[model samples]
Target: MKKSQALYRSVLIIILCGVGFMYSQSESVYQQVEEAVANSISKGVQVGQEALPIQLETLKGEQVSLDDYLGQPVVVNFFATWCHPCQEEMPIIVEMEKRLKEKGAAFVAVNMTSQESSKDEIAPFLQHYRATFDPLLDKDGEIMKKYQIIGIPTTLVIDENGIIVQRINGGLTFELMEDLVIFRE
Candidate 1:
């Protein structure tokens, strides 16, 4: 009986230790996420770097490649229709794109994987929000992962050579993105 009791207590201790280790690892992960988000929110460097080609599925189920826009300045923002910050910035984004139309910039909104939304649901959401820019549906988050996106409303400004000049992690204003996209004086 004594030996059996010792074995049970040892097993219980091992289980508790395992649980504690798991909790610690989880906390570390959260900290890393927070730090990453913080770094993204800070003033982003004008990276002046080229981006690798990545393909995404369009809302119509056709494959779209970023390389297709290689010669133009592309502004890509990752968002969700249900995301309020995303909604709040749509008007600004639309205005920015409109104001800088002659600069050959492409302002694109890539919607996140929304379990509750289909292409049908997205149409009304786009119209209701006055989002003039066509929002591509990231149905499987494959595109999102390509960019290592960890937060909603992340915007990337790719230069004419397919280089990612700016990576803005948070919401951006029309004025701000316009400057990044180089709206002509």
Candidate 2:
């Protein structure tokens, strides 16, 4: 009985050590991922750089491309339905859309659906927010990777000349949107 108890204790200690090692490794990995995301966002496309070409399908099944809006300023927003910050910024974007469209500016919301299971929540979410701009779906995350989108609610303001003017990494306020739309360099 004494020998058996010693063996069991040894096994238990080994198992606990293994668990602790795995936990620490997982925490380290998580921190690395966060750092990678931050680095990507910080090093993403800068102002004065030509906007990257984007070819994606809208929710209405229409294909849209960045080239299609070359003659006008464009607001390209990356978001997910499950993101609260993304949701919070939707109304402000919608207002921006309405106000900016009247001035020949295009606002395009791109949904990050690649990591999500289904996009069924999109319609209801848009309806709830009264969003009129047809959102493009980044189903395979190609657009996200192309844009180096490390986080949701990242927005890019592109000028009529196809140069990126501003990049926002968080929820946008109405005043900021207004300023971005009105003050173009």
Cand. 2 TM to true fold? 0.73
Per-residue CA lDDT of model 2 for 1-185, tens digit only, reads 99999999999999999999999899899999999765554323667677878889998999999889998888889999898899888889888888777887888889998966688888888999999878899999998888888888999998787878889988998778767845444
Q: What is the C-alpha lDDT of each candidate?
A: 0.72, 0.85
Per-residue CA lDDT of model 1 for 1-185, tens digit only, reads 99999999999999999999999899899999999765554322236555655576666577767777877788777887777777788777777767557666676667786533655777787788576766677777766766777877888877776667778887877667656745546
Please give the lDDT score at residue 18 for candidate 1: 99
Task: Record all residue pairs in model 2 with backbone atoms less than 3 Å apart, i.e. clashing.
Answer: none
What TM-score does each of the candidates earn?
0.65, 0.73
Backbone clashes for every candidate come to: 0, 0
